[model samples]
Target chain A: MSIFLSILALVIILISAGLLFFLALPPKRRSRWGLRPIPAFSELVRVLGLSVEEGTRLHLTLGHAGITQPTSASALVGLQALERITAISSVSDRPPLATSGEGSLTLLSQSTLRAVYRLNNALDLYDPQRGRLTGVTPLSYAAGMLPIAYDENVSAHLIVGHYGLEIGLLCEAAVRNNAFTLAASDSLSAQAVLFATTKQPLIGEELFAIPAYLQTSPAHVASLRVQDLLRWGTVIALVLSAVLGVFGWL
Target chain B: MVMRSPVATAIAIGVGLIVLLGYLLPLPVLDPIRRLFLDWSIILAAVAGLVAILNLFKAHWRKISSSRERDYYSLFFILGFILTAALGLLFGPTDERVRPLIMSIQLPVEASLVGLLTITFVVSAVRLFALRRSWMSGIFLASTIVFLLAGSGVFLTSGTSQVIKEVLAALNILPAAGARGILLGIALGSVLTGLRVLLGMDRPYSE
Candidate 1:
């Protein structure tokens, strides 16, 4: 079983790498890969424009996941959200704010902010303080984010990361301020809670689709395609396994 | 469009691949190298924590100094940080006084937050129905109410009928199934993200 799983894993890697190199390398094809609309992202774009025009900041938080942890994939998505939003709204007087729970994530968020600003030639306006480490603990992290949600005149909140039930408090803070809250998390518990609390709740793998929705790059779009194909493949495998189990063909 | 930090990218990709190979295959040659990399990662992570503290201070300092956004409350953060760091440095993490002092403050605060979460959850459920009153919303509210009752052990009493137990058991599978579906998607995403990082096809580390 271990060897079989190992082979399967290797095949996935090969497939991903192959698709990335041959099928998805061209930049022109990026726009042609039509994506299904996620309502939250649509709302996000609309809210982003409102924020810029109304001169209010958009706050993006990467929930408490350290860089070395497996949950960091969610943080990566959060950073992508930050990058895209900052690129789009770098001209706004109030630039986007990114808050994170973990230390390495804080530094990374700062780096991403600087990179985006530089890319847009708004380097002089870039501030490291824009990316903040709210708190190390879950509840404290949520508490730390409340000010950004409430006091910062934030018009929109983008929360895409690994989070737990503490996300409820963050959502509550945003909702209280009447901010447009779009929250997604890798954690099941967080998603379940966020569905009700957040204005726009991103479910399951929808969080990973942020970059593609933002039209960041071809790689993001390609990865979304890869995810779709692999999801179907996994569904098939599950069905086959169930059939094999029922028939005593193990 | 192009690699902003080619050297950094190459190093990240190489280190990632080596560490990945170490975990995947039981190659003796790679184990020590992997261990060394991991130890280095731990040290770097600790340093990163220190950097975060510095950043936290810097951010709060700005808030305190800003004329319009003069958050004098930030003085509390700066003071608390200094005290905590001094305590931790004077006596190691395992010191008896430190744990009690930290937890004494953390416990009540976290407990209050958790308590507040329940209220938030209830309020949000009401808000959800108020905002979107559809068939799906109805079903969601009904299920949530049912689960809240079930969770409180109201349905598990001796007076409850066999049918009730059986139905509850069956309904429980729905959430488990939903959870599995979500987990599968997250796992697929993690796998894809990992590959992207390892291959250096996606670099969140820089532009």
Candidate 2:
């Protein structure tokens, strides 16, 4: 049974990867994939634009999940979003402040900032201190972020990563400071807090679609399409299995 | 256009394939290699964690020396970190003194944060109703009320209570089904994300 499941997963992954690769390869005639408009992402782009115009700084938090952990997938998505934001907001007086709960995430965030700066040929303005490690533990991380959220110069806060219940404190702080807060998390408990506190919240796989929506990266679009296809396939498989089980055909 | 690093891409693809194949295959020759790769990864992560700690100290130190308004808090943070590390290292990690320190300081703080979640949950539930007056919100509100009443044990003696208990038992299956679906989706996402890294479609490591 274990072997069967492994093989099944492998086959599905291979198929998805193949489809994505094929879709990504056609340079001139790329498939036009449409995703439901995520207001939070759109708002984020707008906020970054406003920040550039107003000279206000934006704050982004990558939750405490280390890059080595399974939750790092969300962190990767958050980095992608950070890259896009940094690219757009490079002209601002102060670059966006990015914080992380874990050490590796801080390093990755700094690397991301450097990469963005290098891409824009503004490496001279890149400040390593902009990407900071706040805390190692969840509560400490949340507590440490309060000041950042409360800063007067911070006009917006975008948090996307793996967070738990402790995220409530940070969200509340952001709310109290009147910062335009957009949050997304893979953790259900954090999602609950975000639903209450944030004006814009990205739920479930919507968090993963930020890069696809922001950039017309063929690979990202193809991945999004494949993910949707796989979801529908899973639903169909579940229905078929239920029908089979009812008839005792298994 | 940004130039792609072929070496980085090759390394990512090669390492990703070996790790994936290692987990799925049980061949005797590949097992040791897989174990070696896993060990190396663990070692690298540990080193990275140490570097992170050093960076943390440097960040706080700079803050302490700077004229920022929050420099005092940075001072406290640095002091606390150094003191804690000293105590933990001087006394073994499993020593009685160290255990109590963690239990007293960290555990209660974390528990209080969790306890605070109940208030947050109520706030979120109310906000959900106010922000979105849709069927999904209605269903969520109804479910929360039902579960709360069922678990309260306030009407256990009544005949209606038995019916309520039965309904509650049936409703329990709904979350389990939902959880399964969520897990399946997350699993698929993780796999695809991994495949993307291996295929060099997303070069996070390179970045």
> Model 2 over residues B12-56: C-alpha lDDT tens digits?
688778877777866677778778887887777677667777887
DockQ computed for model 1 against the true two-chain complex using alpha carbons: 0.69
List fnat per candidate, in order.
0.70, 0.40
lDDT of 2 at B90: 95
**TM-score value, chain A, candidate 2:** 0.95
Global lDDT for candidate 2? 0.78
List model 1 lDDT by residue over A1-250, tens digit each.
3767767777788887787565466857545568987887888899999899999999999999898888999998888778889888989989999999999999888988899888877789998889889998888888999888878899888989988998999888888888898888999999888888887888899888888899887778888888988999999999999999999996
In model 1, which regions exceed 4 Å deviation? Answer: A27-31, B1-3
Clashing pairs in 1: none
DockQ of each: 0.69, 0.49
> Could you give candidate 1's per-residue lDDT for residues B162-206 as a string of tens digits?
999999898889889989999999999888877777777667786
Worst 10 residues of 2 chain A by lDDT: A25-34
Which pairs of residues collide in candidate 2?
Answer: none
TM-score of chain A of each: 0.95, 0.95
For model 1, state the Cα shift of residue B203 in Å: 1.3
